[model samples]
Target: MCPRRARCFNTTGPCSPQHHYMLPPAQRLPEARELIEMDRYFVLHAPRQTGKTTPP
Candidate 1:
């Protein structure tokens, strides 16, 4: 691993220039999984496209 990256993972001292551009994932993965498990509804819509179907 890049030396700067190891340090930044812990949010310690300023990391070297190599670490500047990384953007973290928008939400931690575990929360996303929980939301998927609880999903109770969904919708599909079409305008110019002519049809729709939902699976059983």
Candidate 2:
């Protein structure tokens, strides 16, 4: 896993060097689940063309 600035890839949409955010579903979902179980609010911010959080 990277402990530094995440490398990014270009997609068929607006993108910039600053929009370096990306994560695997395998990685992000568990973190979301933990926060939900604890009743803590959090935001899912990702780069263009990524998952949209919906309440399960």
Candidate 3:
């Protein structure tokens, strides 16, 4: 197992709560799971620097 590290601010790439101070991605888009489970097509529209690229 890997040792837990202190969280810090992330300026590039994906942000993980375990290693970076960030809002939970799942909470940002609560409906994503339902939409995905339904197997429907959808688009995520957001400005740059937002967590839009993060995995659902």
Candidate 4:
């Protein structure tokens, strides 16, 4: 793992849906609500190693 990337290894399964309650707003950043609500057309872009890839 690169030193710059956050450690995301899961001992069990991927993150739980209820985990959202524990996430701080700033930590999640721009948020996904507005993007889905407004029916907006846009792209979400970021540099590599920035957690931009969606879970499979």
Candidate 5:
């Protein structure tokens, strides 16, 4: 099997969940991965530039 490397930080806009560290404010709070894994519908709110689009 091929090994995988950590994703790099983005310099432009929002980042993928795998690159959460790039947007520290959007870290795994309220258990983002867990919530998503549940397959339930939900929503999140945050100010602009606070990683609102990155699942914070």
Candidate 6:
């Protein structure tokens, strides 16, 4: 078997668990579920370079 590769922070495109170190998207907005369940509309806002455009 091949040796495990090292992971690094992802700077572009979607991140992969095998190649990048990242927090799960869900953890970033835990309240989103509650808002959705209540039938409320909400917007996501964050500082630049915070992975806002990255897909969950």
List per-prediction Cα lDDT, in the order shown.
Answer: 0.38, 0.54, 0.69, 0.44, 0.55, 0.73
The local lDDT score (0 to 100) that residue 1 gets in candidate 5 is 18
Candidate 2, pairs of clashing residues? none
Candidate 5, residue 55: CA error in Å? Answer: 7.7
- Model 4 alpha-carbon drift over 4 Å, by segment: 1-31
| TM-score versus the correct structure, for each prediction | 0.20, 0.35, 0.54, 0.32, 0.38, 0.55
Preferred candidate (TM-score higher): 5 or 6: 6
**What is the alpha-carbon lDDT of model 1 when measured against the actual structure?**
0.38
Candidate 6 residue lDDT tens string, 1-56: 21469887666788777777778756877998899899998887987676666764
Off by over 4 Å in 3: 1-11
Score candidate 3 by lDDT: 0.69
Poorest 10 consecutive residues of model 5 by lDDT? Answer: 1-10
Give the per-residue lDDT digits (tens) of candidate 3, residues 1-56.
Answer: 22467776565676667776677656877997898899987788977766666542
Runs in model 1 lying further than 4 Å from the true structure? 1-27, 40-56
Predicted candidate 4 versus true structure: per-residue lDDT over 1-56, tens digit per residue: 21343444333434433331123333565756576579876565876544343342
Clashing pairs in 4: none
Candidate 5: stretches off by over 4 Å: 1-12, 16-21, 25-30
- Candidate that beats the other on TM-score, 2 or 6, i.e. the better one: 6
Q: What pairs collide in candidate 6?
A: none
Per-prediction CA RMSD (Å): 15.6, 10.4, 4.9, 7.8, 8.2, 4.8
TM-score leader? 6
- Model 1 scores a TM of 0.20
Instruction: Return whichever of 2 and 4 wins on TM-score.
Output: 2
